[model samples]
Target: MLEPIGQATAAAQNIWGDATQWGVGTGVGTVSGGFEFPSVEEIDAVLSSWRARQASIAQRGNTLELMVSSLTQQPAEDDATTGYIATWAQSLTQLRDQHRSMLEYIEDYIKKLEAAKQAKQAGEAENEAAVQKTAGDLAQ
Candidate 1:
């Protein structure tokens, strides 16, 4: 029950990391030296993959919620039942941690994407100005 939830959460985190890297770019070193921009197609592919992962995680979460509700209603009297409940709680905690981390990763990636877009726009504007200047000089 909870085990599946934990696994799904971990999968979500991995998917988030991969999608963010593909969308915004990733590197070590200085920002100016190591920066790399992925093509629009690559970013779109990654976004699609992330959406699929999100759907899977939501399904797992729904299943886990149902199991948890069922378990909660059950009368736990034996040692085995107690142990099972303990294990389920642990798995739930792990799942929550993974989900939180994935959300943070998504937020960070969004910020990175916005910065990249702004930089790209500025560069295009500069190039356009340069071309205009060159054309004017040629006309003279």
Candidate 2:
């Protein structure tokens, strides 16, 4: 059981890389002076990466749920064993909820990124049109 948990933890680490690599909690949505917005391509790349990992996150959540279900089948003839099983199930449930929350976060972030990309592209198009119009005006 612990081994499965360790494997799940490793999977999570693989998805996010490391603690500092998590941009979900910080360094997002806030732009300081001189901070450049990500290029459309960069935003696409991030969306692609997170979309790829979304399935794995869902799988981890499923695994945690399975683990919780398995705890119910464990032999708990003694009071201590029953308490331990209850505790283990509670921990697994918490982990599953965390995974679900992370998945939701990723989904929301991806949508926001997509919206930003669209806005950037639209702005670029407008600028290009303005440049063309000014060029025509100058020729006339």
Candidate 3:
């Protein structure tokens, strides 16, 4: 019934609220002003968490799709019932799309995190090389 769909919509809103809590990194690899970039391992862990969240969104989307399918497949006996079913289906479809959007957002964030991790590692290697070069010059 429409009541159950209403409950599902509330659940989706909670999931979206949780998604907004994630802090997108501020200028990945920016070393100015002493911004401490996360370590590669730390980034990896964050990426893992985001991936898990993405999976959860995907699962919720699947559920919404199933509900929509069930509502749409039912044979409505009257104009009133048809109208109610149509409304429920429309709402569920929109919620499912929102879930898909969240999944995409999380995926994009994961890619950015991976890129930042790589950049940080590269910077560390460059710093180490410079230190060794300076030390060698001093030894001569």
In terms of lDDT, model 1 sits at 0.63
Give lDDT tens digits, candidate 2, residues 77-117.
Answer: 89999888888888888888888889999999889878777
How many residue pairs clash (N, CA or C atoms closer than 3 angstroms) in each of the candidate models, in the order given? 0, 0, 0
The window of 10 residues in a row where model 2 has the poorest summed lDDT is: 20-29
Candidate with top lDDT is 3
| lDDT for position 37 in model 2 | 45
Question: What's the TM-score of every candidate structure?
Answer: 0.58, 0.70, 0.70
* Cα deviation of 99, candidate 3, in Å: 0.9
TM-score of 2: 0.70
lDDT (tens digit, per residue) of candidate 3 on 1-140 = 22334777779766665444445555545544333455778878887888888888788887787787788465758988888888888888888888888888888888878887788888789889999999999999
Pairs clashing in candidate 1?
none
| Clash pairs for candidate 2 | none
Judge candidate 1 at residue 110 and give its lDDT. 57
Each candidate's lDDT (Cα)? 0.63, 0.75, 0.76
Off by over 4 Å in 1: 1-32, 38-71
